[model samples]
Target: MPNLGKLIVHERMRRGIGPEPFADACGISRQTLYRIETGECEPSLPSLRKIARVLHVSPGKLLDLGA
Candidate 1:
């Protein structure tokens, strides 16, 4: 696998958004976002959409296997 979680985190960082603030904006806890970024859990479509909104990125970018 190409580490989807890292891609998410990397994109967030690239966009200058923090996990806590982004997750809060997404209505999810910071810990949960952290887990997603850490590859501890996979996010569902809705969650991915929320995260994409928070990160100011497209859902495809967030879920891109190539980062």
Candidate 2:
């Protein structure tokens, strides 16, 4: 299975987005974003949906990476 953190990082970079703005867009603190991206924490479902919306992806795309 793919690491959720790495997938998040790859997709974020692929879209040319930086962490701060991305976190802001997701309504999360940069520290929370860092934790999620580093596998230190898993995002709450609502947070995951927010992240997917920001990234222009479906939540399943993110979830499937770890499935």
Candidate 3:
């Protein structure tokens, strides 16, 4: 399966957004964003939605689910 963490990093870099600022824009802590990006924890639905909105992507794009 494609790694969700890698995907998040890829998209974030592609958009030229740093982790701290991105997390701030998403209304989440930098540590939480780091954990999510490192695959240490799964994001809650609300968190995922916030991320997707800030990243201009669909939440499904951040999920692995064998896609």
Candidate 4:
């Protein structure tokens, strides 16, 4: 299993993107994004796509399932 939400936060920080603005760019509420980042909730595929798109990254980057 992938820790996708953690990966999202990690990558965002690695790229110097903050949680609040990143959440805004991803079209999610900051609280929801915080829950996801803190591993409280697993995002749906649609949510993942929105996040990935906003972050300018592939879903696999968020999933960390790439070979």
Candidate 5:
């Protein structure tokens, strides 16, 4: 499986988005975003949906789970 943290960080940076703004866009706290990005926590499905929406990606794409 792809590393979720790396994927998120990569996409975020690719879009020129900072952590704080990305977290706010996702309606999550910056600390939560940091934890998820650091592999310290797994985002819930709803959280994933929110993030995916903001990043213009599907949740499965964010999770990297094969169809």
Candidate 6:
């Protein structure tokens, strides 16, 4: 499986976006984002879509990174 959290972190950081504002932009709590990023939880499809939208990448692109 793709390390979704790491992908998210990588993309966010690549864009020079910070955690707090990124979570805010995604409409999720920072704690929830943290959990997802830490692999403590998997994000739902909706959350994945939100994350992808923010990252300016397709959700499939993120998933494909692991393939």
Candidate lDDT (C-alpha), each? 0.79, 0.88, 0.84, 0.84, 0.88, 0.88
lDDT of 5 by residue, 4-30 (tens): 888889889999999999999999999
Lowest summed lDDT across 10 adjacent residues in model 5 is found at 58-67
RMSD per model, one decimal? 2.3, 2.3, 2.2, 1.6, 1.5, 1.9
Tens digit per residue, CA lDDT, model 3, 1-67: 2477788889899999998899999898999889888989877889888888888888877785532
Collision pairs in model 3: none
Model 5: residues >4 Å from true position, as ranges? none
lDDT of 2: 0.88
Which tens-of-lDDT digit does each residue in 1-67 have in candidate 2? 2477777888899999999999999999999999999999999999999999998888888877442
| lDDT of model number 1 | 0.79
Better of 4 and 5 by lDDT: 5
For model 6, where is the 10-residue window of minimal lDDT?
58-67
- Candidate 5, 48: how far from true, in Å? 0.3
TM-score, candidate number 6? 0.90
TM-scores for candidates 1 onward, in order: 0.80, 0.90, 0.86, 0.84, 0.91, 0.90
List ranges where model 2 is wrong by over 4 Å. 65-67
lDDT of 4 by residue, 1-67 (tens): 2487778877789889988889888888999998898888888899899998887888877888681
Error in Å for residue 30 of model 6: 0.2
Model 4 misplacement above 4 A: none
Best by TM-score: 5
Evaluate residue 30 in candidate 3 and report its C-alpha lDDT on the 0 to 100 scale: 93
Worst 10 residues of 2 by lDDT: 1-10
Please give the lDDT score for candidate 5: 0.88
